[model samples]
Structures are given as C-alpha cells and as structure tokens.
Target: MNNQSKQPISPTAHGHRLVVETLNTHPNALRRLHSPGSAENELSELIVHTALHLDTVQKELVDRCTWAAQDLTRVATGTAAPNSLGVLQNSGLQIDLLAARRADAKAHLRSALAAYQRVTTIAKPQHAGPHPPLPSRTSPRTR
Candidate 1:
C-alpha cells in the first residue's frame, strides 16, 4: 500500500470520540448540544436568552415611547386630558431607562458572541497539509 494513500487517524476523529465520551460521562451533556449545565455553555446560553429578551423589551419600549409622544403632543395641543401629563412624564423616564438598558444589552451580546466564537475556534481542526497551488493562466505567446 502506498504511504500517501494510507492516512493516519485524524485529530477530528479523536475529538469526536472525546465528545462522545464526555457526553456519556457528563450528567447534563444529553440535555443540550453545548452542555447546558456547564459554566461556559450556560453563560453563553444565558447571554443569548438575555439579549433576545432585551430585544423584545426594546421593541415594546419603542412602541410605548411613540404612544407617549403622541399623548404629549395632544396635551400640548390642548386635546388631551390634564391627568395624561403625569403619565407622559413617567413614560419619558421609562424611555430613558429603556435606552440605557438597550445599550447594556448590546454590550452583553457582543461579549457573548466573542465568548462563543472562542469556544468554536478552539474546537475547529487546523489543517497540517500543504495547500494546493493556484492554476497558472497560459499566455497567448506561451501557448
């Protein structure tokens, strides 16, 4: 048999076996692909969950702010009830809070993405073989 044709066991194969062993031994590995109970995976999942929740909240805040602005406009135009002023003011405060929360959530989402990227990068296999060279274009003169 040609040495080139007979390949050695791949690192990826070893990694697969290791993952299988880990899944068999770890209590929580069966619950999720990333091992939900593990610290790193759990943190990543939590961050994603929190980011999604924050996105929903941000959308709601935007709607509320729009409604509040419409109410305030009505108040200024003497179309809204006098008691609506207090509610509009409180809505302004809520809008400010939501803006701050959105900023924080974006930051957390970035951090979580970075953390997850690191984990995936670490798991990826590095190719050891030399890369194939690009095909050369034959010039008219050469042909």
Candidate 2:
C-alpha cells in the first residue's frame, strides 16, 4: 500500500467537518458516493459553503452601498429635504463601512476560492496527458 502523507486540514475546514459528521446521520448523496462519512467530501462541502456565503455577503454589501450612494446623489441634487444634512453624513459613513466590509468579504472569498481549487485539484488529480483515453467513445472536447 502506498503510504501517502496527508496535509493538515485548515481550522475552518476541520470545524466545518465536525459539524457535518455530527449532523450527517442519514444516508445522503455524499454518504452514498463517498462512504458513510468521507473527510474529503465533508471538506468539499465546507469549501463550497464558505465560497457561497462570501458571495452572499458581497452582494448584500453592494446592495447597501448602492442605496447609500442613491441617497447621497439625491442630497447632492437638492432633491432631498433641505434639512437632510444628517442623512447625507450618515449615507457617506454607511457607504464607507459597506466598502470596507465588501473588501474584507472579497479577501475571505479569495481564500475560500483558493482552498476550493486546491481540494478540486487533489480530488481530480492532474492527468498525465492532455486527454485521457476513453473506454470506446470519443472525447467530447475533440468533437
């Protein structure tokens, strides 16, 4: 047997796996395809979840920033109330905070994306040749 040394899993991934193992008491697709509780399958699910969560956070921040920007534009164009100085100030601050949050979310998303790519690479190992030999059918890429 080839005794391959495995790399250490990230803390985030490990914690996520713990939750999965605890909750995955039933026979799900992951269990059916990758045994009762495969660590790789659990990690894959965590990576996907983290990436999607970041996507959601980024979208929310963008929506909030857009609203704040619209408010500022209205104030600038004198369309808003004359006594809306407080609203203008609050809108600017709100935009700044939203931008900062979006930046942080982007950083986290990049990390999660990298982790996901690494896991995918490991799961589907690099093929020696450009195209792998098929059983009998021609490769779709060649068609």
Candidate 3:
C-alpha cells in the first residue's frame, strides 16, 4: 500500500501542509476578495503595494523566526518552558510546532517576494539611448 494508506495523517500535519500550499499560490491569486484596484491594474500603484507587502511579510517572517529560535533554544538546552500558546507541552512537540510555524512564515515571505518581482517587472521599461543614425547608403561614408 502507498504511504498515504499506511498511516493516518494528523490534523496538525494536514493543516501545516495546507498553510504551505496556500502561501505558495500565485500572489495575485492568493486573496480573491478584491482585484488590484479593478481589473485594469495601475502598474505603478501595484508595484508600490507589492513592495510594501514584501516589506511587511519580511518583517513578520523575521519576527516569527526569532520566536522559533527562542523555542529551539529552550528545546536544545533542555529548559522546560511553556510554548507560545502557554501550553507546557513536551519539548519534542514544542519544537515540531515551532518548525511548522517558521516554515509557514518563510513560505509567505517567499510568495511576497515573488509578487513584488512580478509587479515591478514592468514598472520600468529598459531603453537603450537613441541609436546612431543608419549607416550612410552612399559609398562615401565618413570614417
């Protein structure tokens, strides 16, 4: 039998997988409640919004990661303490929970970066300065 049939999936694991999938979805498609200010998107406005979002997401991920690090230290140093939820769970469980949270936050950050890159791609058009005039058709071309 396949691994799926071999064992039952825990709700926590299932939820963690869902969170990862949601975060990995295309940026524009993530929140379907609204469009980028109507179907006709304003490139500059979208870029600004996406950049702001990236910054926020990055900060959130960093914060969450910091928390996770603290938890890791607690687990590693064999210090007994309540997890983020104020539950005195076993160290193993605490570490697993913290890992899942960190993974989700990192996934979100990655998705935000992707969204920013997408919106800013067209924000600026690359143009080589004016090209030299076409070569003189006449044989007497200047050296």
TM-score of 2: 0.48
lDDT by residue (16-113, candidate 1, tens digit) is: 22223322322223225465566557755655465455556567677788888788788789996657347767888889887787667666656655
Ranking by TM-score: 1, 2, 3
> Alpha carbon lDDT of residue 100, candidate 2?
77
Off by over 4 Å in 3: 1-41, 82-143
Ranking by lDDT: 1, 2, 3
Q: Taking the candidates one at a time, how many backbone clashes does each contain?
A: 0, 0, 0
Tell me, by lDDT, which candidate is best. 1
Residues 89-126, model 2: lDDT tens digits? 77678767866765675566456545644664687866
Worst 10 residues of 1 by lDDT: 22-31
TM-scores for the candidates: 0.54, 0.48, 0.32
Clashes of 2: 0
Compared with the true structure, model 1 gives a TM-score of: 0.54
